[model samples]
Target: MKLLLDFLPLVLFFGAYKMYGIYVGTAVLMAATVAQMAIIYAIDKKLTTMHKATLALILIFGGLTLFLQDERFIKWKPTVLYTAMAVALAVALWVYRKNFLKMMLGSQLALPDPVWNRLTAAWVLYCLFMAAINGYVAAFFSTDAWANFKLWGYVFPLAFIVGQGIYVARHLSDEAPAEKTE
Candidate 1:
């Protein structure tokens, strides 16, 4: 359910682009993102910082795309978002000596500080990698090619998440109680 909600905006954007083109697709994406956030807020009663950042970036970039009639704005949105995330994570870890990922997920998952540090560093690198790839495609490719890449780009994140899950699983403590003897 949550996963569907998360993908709904991107799915709608791609479908709209296929039918109408970039401007219409941008509008659909903006609307769908708003609806997605509303539904998430209704269910969770609060939005995370990441959620708010995503919503803001979508609206701002989507609005610029529509208002300026430039596909570049929408195309560059992902690059900008990924770059910002990478910088934020890097700065939080290096300059502030704080791990933002650990701060957010620590309550749910208990891991050693070293593991958290490694995870945060991995996230920073992953974000920079994503930002660079998106920027490269958006700059050199045609709009149609960029749009297709945006849709197919799910593979990268899916792989990253699976790999992260595997790494984190190795560090998770076995909290289950031992079997009782007769």
Candidate 2:
């Protein structure tokens, strides 16, 4: 359910691009993203920092794409987003000695400090890789090719998430069952 909501804007954008064109697709994406965020807010009662950042970037970049009549802004948005994420995580971890990933997910999962550090490092590297790949495709490829990659590139995140889950599963500490009270 949540996953579907997460992908809704992208799917709509891809479909709109396929049927119409990049400009129309960008409009559809902007509208769909706003709707998606609204639904998320309704369900969660608040938006995370990441969600707000995504919404802001979409509006800013999408608005630029439409206002300037240039597709480059939209094409480079993902690279910007990924690069920012990578930088934020890396700086927080290495410079500040803070594990932002653990701060975000620590309550949900019990893992050792070393495990959290590794997880944060993995996220930093993953974001960098994603940023580079998106930038490469957006810069060198045609609009159609980039659009195709946008739709197909979901594979990378899905695989990365599954692999992260597997790695975390091994380190997860088993909680003891609570005792029954009369």
Candidate 3:
């Protein structure tokens, strides 16, 4: 549900771009993200730091794409986003001496410290790899090609992310009983 909600704007952006052109499509996408941010603020009364950063990137990069009338700007958005995430994760573990994923996921997943460290490393590697792929697609392909990659390429990493989650779950403590809601 959360994923679907978060994805709505991107879907809308793609649909609009396909039907119209970059200017209108970018406008629609920007508005959609703003609406989502509004809802988040309304619901939580305080914007999360990550959410704020994401919104800023969307505005700056997305706005530049529209203003400059260049599709490459928007295409580079993912590279920047993924690279920023990877650097943040890597630096958290290496320099800050903290497990970044734990800060993000530990509340829901009761994994051990070692598991958290390994998972954080995996995420860092994943981000770095995806950043490279995003660059390749955007550089070598047409705008449409890169957009399609953005839309379809999501499934690949997400599938792996889920698989990693399941693998992590296997190591859950035997004493930690499962809770099933009716």
Q: Can you rank all candidates by TM-score, best first?
A: 2, 1, 3
Model 2: residues >4 Å from true position, as ranges? Answer: 176-182
Give the RMSD in angstroms, all C-alphas superposed, for model 3: 4.3
Which structure is stronger by lDDT: 1 or 3?
Answer: 1
Candidate structures ordered by lDDT, highest first: 2, 1, 3
For candidate 1, the TM-score is: 0.95
**Model 1 per-residue lDDT tens digits across residues 1-182:** 87788888999999999999999999999999999999999999999998999999999999999999999999999999999999999999999999998888887787889999999999999999999999999999999999999989999999999999999999998774234489
Question: lDDT of model 1 at residue 42?
Answer: 94
Task: Give the clashing residue pairs of candidate 1, or none.
Answer: none
Residue range 42-141, candidate 3, lDDT tens digits: 8779887678877888899889988888777777877888899989888989999988778766666777888889888888888888889999999999
Model 2 over residues 96-129: C-alpha lDDT tens digits?
9999988888878888999999998999899999
Scanning candidate 2 in windows of ten residues, the lowest lDDT window is 172-181
Pairwise TM-score winner, candidates 2 and 3: 2
TM-scores of all predicted structures = 0.95, 0.95, 0.89
Q: Which regions of candidate 3 are displaced past 4 Å?
A: 174-182
Once all C-alphas are superposed, what RMSD does model 1 give against the true structure? 4.7
Q: Which residue runs of candidate 1 sit more than 4 Å off their true CA positions? A: 176-182
Residue pairs with backbone atoms closer than 3 Å in model 2 (clashes):
none
Q: Positional deviation of 126 in candidate 1, in angstroms?
A: 0.6
